[model samples]
Target: MTKKIEVLGSGCARCKQTTKVMEMAVKELGIDAVVEKVEDINEIVNRGVMATPAVAINGKIVFSGKIPSLEEAKALLSKS
Candidate 1:
């Protein structure tokens, strides 16, 4: 299945960085996935994310509150 990856934040630098990290991880891992940026506060809240720079994989949160390292993101995607 194609992995649905979301980086949720307020479009800040951290959020952008997190998105880039996820994209790079996806590229390096060579997996079928898509990285999306979720900046709407309502959507973030709806997802139950209380922090910025959160990562959701296949509609389930896997990381939050900070930018994940490349290795961490790769591992997360691998699991998805």
Candidate 2:
């Protein structure tokens, strides 16, 4: 099954880095998943995330406020 992964941020450096990390994790895991960037403030707030550079798997927030390591991203994706 393909997982819906979202990286939430306002296109800042950290956000981009998080997105990159997620991409690398996905590639390394060889898992079917789609990683999207959520840059809209309202959307991010609506999702109940006050911090930028957050991650959500299948509409559920998994990580927030900081960029996760490759292994962390892989673990998060694996759960979904």
Candidate 2: misplaced stretches above 4 Å?
none
lDDT of 1 at 30: 89
* Candidate 2: residue pairs that collide: none
lDDT of 2 by residue, 1-80 (tens): 78888999999999999999999999999989899999999999999998889999999999999999999998988877
Q: Lowest summed lDDT over 10 consecutive residues: which window, candidate 1?
A: 71-80
Error of 2 at 36 (Å): 0.6
Candidate 1 Cα misplacement greater than 4 A, ranges: none
Output the lDDT of residue 10, model 2: 97
The CA-based lDDT of model 2 is what?
0.94
